[model samples]
Target chain A: MSYPRLLRRTLLYIGATAFALWVLIPIFLIAISSFTPPNEIYAWPKPIIPSRFSLDTMRFFLNSYGVLNSLRNSILVALLTLAFTLAVGAPAGYAVARFSFRGREAFRLGILITRMFPTALLAVPLAVTFIKWGLYDTLIGVALIHTAMALPFAVIITTGIFMGVPKDLEEAAMTLGCSRFGAFVRVALPLALPGLAAAAMFTFVISWNEVFAATILTVNNRTLPAHILTTIQASPLYFRFAGGFFMTIPALFFMFFIRRYLFHMWGGATAER
Target chain B: MAAEIRLEKVRKTFGKVVAVKDMDLLVEPGEFLVLLGPSGCGKTTTLRCIAGLERVDHGRVYIGGRDVTELPPSKRGIAMVFQSYAVFPHMTVAQNIGFGLRMRRAPKNEIKKAVQEVARLLQIDELLDRYPSQLSGGQRQRVAVARALVMRPEVLLMDEPLSNLDALLRLQMRAELKKLHREVGTTTVYVTHDQIEALSLGDRIAVMREGEIMQLDAPNEVYDMPANVFVGGFIGTPPMNFLRAEVRKEDGGVYLAVGDFSVEVHKEWQEKLEGMVGKKVVLGIRAENIEVRPTPEGGALPARVVVSEPLGAQQLLTVQVGKDVLKVATSTELSATPGQTIGLVLTKAKIRLFDEESGEALKFD
Candidate 1:
């Protein structure tokens, strides 16, 4: 290669390596510290590699008061958020992408504008309503708020997903003895599956990571992130590292399982052959 | 079985823009009717209304003697092939062709047999296991056709089906489609903007313009006796040449007085010309109907050639007659250079006259 082209490629590699290290090093440090014995975790200078591995810190973090309950609450709330968001947002997205009616653009803008309001401002009123409805301090109340928070992103992403599927295929199905709904289910749905999976992943991640809404809505049923934020400062350094490491694993596993579908969100799936 | 389709005073509009005006049409059973027009001329809209894809604001549509105006596309007993050849990209060729049967809950064996038969007919049998993305454009188009034909629909609707193909493949597929229609004998309504395809593939051509049908006739009748000036101009390659003329009476004989010269009107049209004396009319003549002669003859109009284009089989000469330019197609043997003076002989029997104001053909009986 010519000198300039070689120099440009080398610079690109350097930038990519720096970015990779920047994201991976903190996770690496927490993982190592999480497994290190309690005494070594408090060493004068932190070791790059642990002297020995032990599950004692992880065991203690798991056995702590409210930790296991909060872990279960987080999974339930994230699942509930995903189910509610898709059930409501998918049809709304389909309508937004496929139909042209008065106020269509306004409806989309209105959904997006819901996110512009500060969450803190709505907390007192939402908590008051939840208490009246007997939903405060319940997992369901926290999940409801997370669903509301993730809905705009779900609708927007699924709209783009549905738009990538050609209207012609659906119309063709309708002519071939399928009703309008049937056409959507058989033809448009299959074509949009990958992108929808990507949307579901985003919804899950958003709900899992959201702390403010979860913390404000639930007192006894705090999700993992809300529970961690409330208790991490009081804990020892080893417990803090173990809690961080535990929280990051589920999200990492979720992403790894669905990594192939993530590219579909970036226009890898199109109608053309 | 083939079934007739009838539209009664159908009209459709989209937000104050009329896509199809009040139109009436009848397609005989087993007849292949082509709706031919320019873009935005409502031909496709008319076809969609018949297919039950678009609802007419006023009027009724009947298919096989039943009122189907309120029915959805599936319940109307019609199958359509879209311009994009919308084969299901996620399905294999066999699955695509068998989708209708599957939707109707056909038995697995029956569905497989029907798909196989249609695939063999379309000559895509070997490719039935392949996905749409693995096939060529032409093959995917065949898969689409097979899917529609497998339904044995009462009426088949096609919206510019072959327009996406290359020119050579389009010609090939056009012939294949005609043959398939003949074999199946299904009533079909096809829409296209190409005059050649309309003339070749249609049993009857409905020429449309500006949301209305200008003429509906056999291909030969449409080409030979166009009902209006628009049909005449829109149907041919080097569209018909028109010149402004006025009817004049001299020596007890009627004549058409073009810019600086006059031609005697045919005897059968003399009386009609008498009533139109001093009235402006349009004189339309096809390029192939005008003959170029080397020397001036008794009834030939003298003209000067402006440009000559050799199209292999024949030569097209642009000749100036008085102040108007006319296209004349002649045998390739006749070589005429630019600025060369030539005599033009218009075939009197084939000449057409139109009202200058309305652009409607003036008939002489």
Candidate 2:
């Protein structure tokens, strides 16, 4: 290879690495500060690397009023939201992908338009309806609202996923003695699994990190993100940083669980066995 | 024993576009019927209707002795191999072949045995454990065929299954498919736009055009005696030459006049053209049947050679005959050059006549 081309490629890699660090530095700072001892968090000329590591902030956050309850509530709400979003959105995606119906495009556009509406605009009306339905301050109510928030994107994402699955496989299944429903179960569903997993991961992260509707719809059953927002201003800097890290940890793990599927869904459609 | 398939007056329409119009076809038991046509000619639609993959707007589909028009694909007792090799990418080949058995909840041993037998028959036993992505195109297609064959369906349908293969592989698989059909003897319906594939694989060929069957007959009969100008032009390479001619009654005998070259109509067509004395008709003659000679002979039409294409065993010569260029297939060694005048003799009995208005074949008595 020519020295100029090799030198140019090296410069390109250096530029990309610099940009990556620029984006990731704040997240890394937050991570390190979450593990730093409370006394060392705000030390003068703050240490680029803390001399000591401790879990005192995490322990304090976990022991705070309703913190553990909210943590449990957040996990429950995210799971329920994932289930509800998939239940309401996956079949809609399948229908939009596979069939030509009157108003199919209109239906898709209508669903996507819901995402343009401010969540805060719907929060008050949804809160009022939940109160009237005797679902106020319940995890189910909060999960339902999160499902409403995530469903539009979920439907759009899943539609693309199902569209990636070829119709030929389903027809092949049917001709091989499977009923229409059987074909879906045996062929299309399995091929669409990676996309479905990615969509589920997206819903779980959205519900886990959501705050406005969670705070509006629930008071006693506030999710972890809602609880942190209500109390973070009053907490110490170290405690606040620990709370942020705690809420982010689950999302990180969620991404980790579906990282392979995300790669498979987007690239390497068929890897050598 | 194999079952017969019958489609009675099937009509299918997609919105305002008619895909199949009042199509009727019958496939006898154990016979290979090929639906041959160009793309969008409704041949695949008819096959899909038989498989219950499509619903006919008005018609009945029967397999064996049972009406299967209202049945789902699984209940229709038929299997289909798609043009794209549709073997499941997620499953191993053995699982793909055994999927039908598993769907029917057959015993595990039975499913394994059937899958093994089919894999062996297709010479893909070693590939049974490999996923579709790991196999080559031909292997994947064999796995698809095995998957359908293991079902032991009453009728088997294939939609241009060999079109995806390369030319040499297509020829090899064509012979293999013929051998497999002979061994299994399942009533088969195949669809292809390639006339060569149709002629070689089909027991009977149904030539379709614009959502209608133009002719349904034995392959040799369809090739030797095309039902219309379309079939004649579509079935052969370097297609048939169509010349417009006027039928005239001269000296109490009918003769076809072709720009200063008039030939008496054969005695076989004498009765058929009795009432059509002054009518314009299209004369259809295949390239292979047009005999070209270097020497100008009596009763021959003189023409100039435009170009010659050597095709190994034979040469296809384009000759100019009174401002119309016609393709003539001659022996490769028959030496001829461009701008050279040659005498062409179109055999009388081999000439076909078509109605200029309707493009329908005019019968000869």
Candidate 3:
């Protein structure tokens, strides 16, 4: 209605729009640059566009230094981590939510405490232990460590999901025909499937994206994140940008797969606790 | 329309707190047995014990003459409709009702037929394709009943199943539950804290208090001749009014001394209460049985109506008598405003007396 109000409103809109662009621009540039010809990629302040697009840099990242093997290792490691976390975490979540066993409250507190310890603190000791166990470069070793890393989060997410399911329904199942375990499998678990799916996806992504632990834990058998670190940096800024793009694709794809349950299980919960 | 069920000294304890304490009950074949009590008073625990959902700490359970305390619910041949319906959200109504049938590995054709028949019986045939979330509260309630009945188990246990429904729906469902039980002929154990439900639906009601059954009999008998103060007070609408009183023998005549007045014990009651003479007791009378009229020839306690709750057919009158407030329900269609002086009479036949210390009925031994 007034000029100052109009100007203020216009300034606010521009500020908000600029903020959004600032966040998304680097991601967009990495995607475009990852496909650019390496000869022109490092030119000047930066090429506004890749006049000729090629997959050479992406192809190079895939083959050289066994980056493709790293990708496979990361997927395999993440999958194993997801499976183990869900297997161990789901039951733990159910027990913490539904039962009143001794030290149950302490068990929940213990899960939280495990997450509080810095990953760096465990890296050296874990590496030393892995070597002794003949698992230093093995995917299973990486997966087990990743499970411990992802377990607290998996347990917390699924605990919330199990709590949301009314206890009356499970008890009702018990009365009808189900044993206590049967009720969980036939009733509670199925209802919590979406939340469990999201938890598994998240644990996978966390395992996939982890580099410090991966670097410390392995030498030749490395994950994508650990392998990328050796070649992603170049004398040129463009290679760094290209590597960023390569690391982000799997995460973006995985995020999309569980995007529905992200807002559902994680967004509301993970932010607070 | 119900199966026979028996509990022999069933006792359940949760840590230090006893939930159902050494309860023994019997339900006749084709009869509806309702366990009624306040929250935490063990009605639900009793029902769950019968369903084998909860294990008894020290007793045996029997359904249709076979010992079932050691058997699981399915093996005991019982089905339960939960307060929350317990219908699987992922399945259609048909699948939910047919689940037990499938568990029995019934022939596919028979399972389909049973589900269809129960669906039609409960008028949920059209809802068979829909999920539980798609149905209304009342529709889901019917679906739960259909689910339990389709199994045709020997017994059916329901725990406060109608409590989640709206008032109008509750009344409608109560009537429908009676009709359904009549048709299905499964022995049913229904539990509720609502006195009205206990009265209306239970063929025989067991009034429980503090983990023990106070009284168990035909619903009308439990209502009319309650065993003790708690049963008398707990099994009626607005609850029966209880006041401290003393029974005394005066001038070769037996009398009960109540608040602000004394009434001559009717000859029949005089003999039954002879032992309570000169003893302090609780005077119990239902709200409706406490008549407020113009001093009826006998000396009646004069009181002022403190508040009047007027329903169209009947009204509840809260009156002050000797520093104690009493609720009196009237069917005379009389209107009395607050502070209006009224004569209240406690008719002898309708009066109940209990020992003050033990709270046990003081009747002829």
Candidate 4:
């Protein structure tokens, strides 16, 4: 085509490539640090090339302060958040997509409004409630708070997903032999499954990385991120690096696992307006 | 093998906007019934109401003579193929076809046999394991049909199913679909805005307008005798022309006078125009019925050829008669140029008279 048009395309491609590298460098650095010698973690130029590596730092972080249990706690909370989000949020999402009620618009606005509040504001009050309810230091209690935190977003995202599944397809299912609920479960649900998986991934990451509520609500049930925050204060510098490495590795891997979905959700955001 | 479907006095509305109003129709068993209309003419809404996709505000819906107005769609044993094809993107052709059976918790072997049977019937066995995204548009349409057929639904409702296909594919699918219906003998309600498709495919065509059916009749009869000006004008491509005219008595013969030109009313329509010989009326003549002449005769009118559109095998010519433009389809491939002057005669046999005030076609009785 025209020279200016070709030049613009090249520049856009290069700019996107540069942005991806810029975002990944920090993550890459933390991962490499896990292999650096403990003493050289203190050295200048920051051990870009480690002469020797050891599993010592990683092993140490894993065994140090119930870090394993913290990881276990993190998985449990993420899964529980997923379960609660899907169970409660799916029906609510279906309702918003299929029916009109008196306060439907207001309810949608209210869901969005919940996302605007800072999660930190709930820490103290939630802590008091959890202690009073005898759930102060349990993984179950921790998961409940995280679920509450992720619930609104789950509802909003799944609602959009269900809306994308053609309303006619569900009705078609009904005439072929599905009850109203059965059609949702049979036709609509399967069609929206990919979107639901993305919603679950989002809620999982939110629960996994949540530190404020996890820190306020528990001592014994400290999640992975909360445990990392505590470990960084007193641990050796390399141990801190190792802990950060473990957390980012899964986060990076999981993000990559659902990169296609993330692109769609992100693209969907930009495309709508 | 197909179910009879009937909608008696069915009405549906969303707030103040009525989507369907007092719709009453019958689709005979094993018959292909086409709902023909423009977008938002309540054809799709009527299909959804029959499918229970939309609840009726008033009246009843029946399938195979059973009241299913309030029954959930699934229990009514009707299958619908959507305008978009609606093949499950994540599932393979086999899985998509197997879905309804799977929902019923049919035994594994039975589901397999049903899927295979439908796959063969639709000639999509080669695509059984391929996902919808992998299939071409025509193949996906076939898979959707296979999916609905696998359910063995008593009635098949297709909502503009072929509207998304390419022109050639649409024609191909139309033929194959007709053949499949012949073999399967399923009563089908097919909706389309393309009157060509409706006329060609529907055993009986229902021409609808503004949430109400203007006429429901056999394709040939409807085309030959439209109930009103809207049906007369909307049913044909290149449409029928309306010449503003007045009924006048001259030499004891009734005739319509349009501007400086007049066409003698045939003896057959003389009595039809008896009321107020000076009253206004509209004369509707289909394009193909406008005969071109080399020289102006007593009944011939002068016209200027303005535009010529070459439709394969025939050329569509637009002629301006006085202030009115009329389309004429001619099989003679003689290249005609715009700005050419010619004389055209409106054949007496093809003239349809309508009351200009009410738009209703006039009958002698």
The candidate that achieves the highest lDDT relative to the unseen native structure: 1
What lDDT tens digits, residue by residue, belong to model 3 across residues B1-365? 34588889999999999999998888988888888998999988888888877878999998888898988766778888888877788789998888877777889999999999889999999989999889999999998888888878788889889999999999999999999888777788898999899899988999988999899899888887888878888887788788788888878778888764786667887766676678888888888777788443457778778999887779888988777789998875676888888888887788777889988887654
| Candidate 2: tens digits of C-alpha lDDT, residues A204-239 | 999999999999888889899899999888888987
DockQ of each: 0.80, 0.80, 0.56, 0.58
Per-residue lDDT of candidate 4, residues B1-365 (tens digit) = 67899999999998888989999999999999999998989999999899888889999999999999988777788888998887777678888889889878999999999999889988899988888888999999998898888887789989999999999999999888888888888899999999999988889999998889998999987787788899888898877888888898887778889888888878877876766599988889988887776556656788788998888878888888787888888766555679887777888888888899999887765
Indicate the DockQ of the complex predicted as candidate 4. 0.58
Docking class of 3: medium
Clashing pairs in 1: none
Which residue pairs come into collision in candidate 4? A174-B73, A174-B74, A175-B73, A177-B74, A178-B74
The per-candidate count of clashes, in order, stands at 0, 0, 5, 5
lDDT of 3 by residue, A26-107 (tens): 8898888889877777677777788888888676556565767898899999999999999999888777677788897777
A-chain TM-score, model 1:
0.87
Q: Is candidate 2 or candidate 4 better by TM-score?
A: 2
Residue B10 displacement in candidate 1 (angstroms): 0.9
Instruction: Write one digit per residue (lDDT tens) for candidate 1, span A1-273.
Output: 999999999999999999999989999989998998888988878778888889999999999999999999999999999999999988988988899899987887788899999999999999999999999999888888998999987887787778878899999999998889999999999999987888888889989999998888888888999999999889888889999999888678778866655544333223311
Model 3: how far residue A209 lies from native, Å:
0.5
Instruction: Please give the range of 10 consecutive residues that has the lowest summed lDDT in model 2 chain B.
Output: B263-272
Chain A TM-score across all models, in listed order: 0.87, 0.86, 0.84, 0.87
